[model samples]
Target: MAKTVIVYFSGYGHTRRIAELAAQAAAADLVEISAEGEVSEAGWSQLDAAQAIIFGTPTYMASPPWQFKKFADATSKKWFTRAWQDKVFGGFTNSASLNGDKQVTLISLQTLASQHGGIWVSLGLAPANTKAATRADVNNLGGSVGALVQSPADASSDEIPPGDLETVKLYAARVADVAKRLHG
Candidate 1:
């Protein structure tokens, strides 16, 4: 069976919640990218073995955190060898504000996947932006490039907005489904 993994860097706890939820929803393994120190070699091996990789990180200054960038940069060797070629890729980002330039982070992730010659996947669920939509709705932010989540800067991991997390779960499922379809 094809393996799916969630490789993420969470400066704050909010993005970690989304990553955990995504892993649970997809029945995927989780690999947390470290900022304070080196990432485990096992993590790299897991990523190398995965058929689908979901990148998660918080949006900082309208882009991914420098820690995540460092991790990306470290993959230069893999990039040159096309180790990730033909793999499925997806991403999710969270921020303090509703319109926190999250798209930029997703775009960056897409570019990273492209550089690795991987396929990029988007959240396929319909956006629940209708006036009648409630906080319980899915795809509330209308994120197309990737899963977009809103996490108040002051909120704890458990306090993540239910709607945004739901969006993550749905996106996770979609990515897993696509990978399965392709690999099977």
Candidate 2:
């Protein structure tokens, strides 16, 4: 099996739940990007050793949280060394509004991966766009670039809808499968 690492910074907690489910599904190590915008040397070691790295962050102002950006900025050393080149990369994001510009966050992650010369892995599932598509349906958000989810503004971390998590698990599985095939 390919070694996988999930690095995430959850502002409220909804994003943390998604990251946890993704880590569980992928059988990957979970590294929390601190709100203080710092990661231990061990965290960098895990990222360097992993075959896959998945990013998770909340969508704030149509982009990733500031801490996540700080985390990305901190990777300049690895980027300069091309240490993560060719590693499989994937990402996920969540927001309060149904159309809360989550795509911007996903794109930011992809761009960061690109800077590291990593291969970006996308969510391969088709959009569940049928008339019967429910809020609990998989890929209902029509996110192809990455996992995108909507949580109610007032909902707590425990109140995250199941459908969003199901999609996150499935997407992480896809990334793990591809990494296994490529690096196992």
Candidate 3:
């Protein structure tokens, strides 16, 4: 099977929880980008070795946090060397509002993967936007480009909607499956 790795930046632990769930579901390695926008050398090595890479981050002001941007910038070396060429990639984003312009964040992540010559994975789940759908239903947010999670502003990290958590697990599994098929 192809190895998968999740590299994420969590501002207030919410995104961290999602990354943990994703890593567990996909049996992937977890690498956290520090608050200072730095990833350890080991983390970079893991990314370089993985057949699949997933990015998780909180949507800040309709985009990823500056720390994620920093990490993306630092990957320029990998980009120039074609180290990540043909790798499978996926991403997820979280925010406080139900419609927090999360698509912008997803696009940014997709663009990053494209720039790295990676194959991007979509959420691949149908939205549960019907009248009776609730937080417990998968794809409650109707996201397609990537997983989208919404946590209320006042809620703790654990308070992220169950549907979103499930979405992350499913998406991670999908990315892993694709990587295994393509790279193994």
Candidate 4:
């Protein structure tokens, strides 16, 4: 099997919860960017050795927090050397509102992957947009670029919508499959 790593920053544990689910479903490693935006040397090594890298972050004010951006900036060395080139990449983002401009964050992650010359993976799941669809149904957010999750502002990390959680897991599996086919 190909090695897959999920690198993420979570402000209030919500993104971390989603990352955990992704990692569980994909059997991937987890590397958390600290609150100060720093990744340990071991984490860097894990990223260097992984065949697939998944990005995760919470959307704040319509964009990823500065910590994740800082982590992205720190990857310039890898970007310049094409270290991540040809690898499979996937991303996920969560926000407090149904349409909290999560796409902006997702696109940012996709662009970051492109900068690294990685192959980007789409959500690959149809939307659960039927009139009868409920929050428990998978792909309720109708995302195609990546996994999109919405946790109400008042909800705890444990209170996220099940559909969103399922979406991330399925997306992670899709990414893992692609990476294994290409790199395993």
TM-score of each: 0.97, 0.98, 0.99, 0.99
Give per-candidate clash totals: 0, 0, 0, 0
Model 4 spans with C-alpha error above 4 angstroms: none
Q: Write the per-residue lDDT of candidate 4 for residues 72-164, one digit (tens) a residue.
A: 999999998999999999999999999999999999999999999999999999999999999999999999999999999889999999999
Any runs in candidate 1 off by more than 4 Å, and if so which? none
- Model 4 error, position 24 (Å): 0.5
Candidate 4 residue-wise lDDT at 103: 96
All models: lDDT?
0.90, 0.91, 0.97, 0.96
Candidate 2 per-residue lDDT over residues 1-184, each given as its tens digit:
8999999998888888899999999999999999897888999999999999999999999998789989999999998889999999999999999879999889989999988888889999988899999878889899999999888989998877777889999999988888999998
What is the Å distance of residue 118 in model 1 from its true position?
0.5
Q: Between prediction 1 and prediction 2, which has the larger lDDT?
A: 2
Supply the global lDDT for candidate 3. Answer: 0.97
Question: Which of candidates 1 and 4 is the stronger one according to lDDT?
Answer: 4
TM-score of 4: 0.99
Give the deviation of candidate 4 from the true structure as CA RMSD: 0.5
lDDT of candidate 1 at residue 181, scale 0 to 100: 88
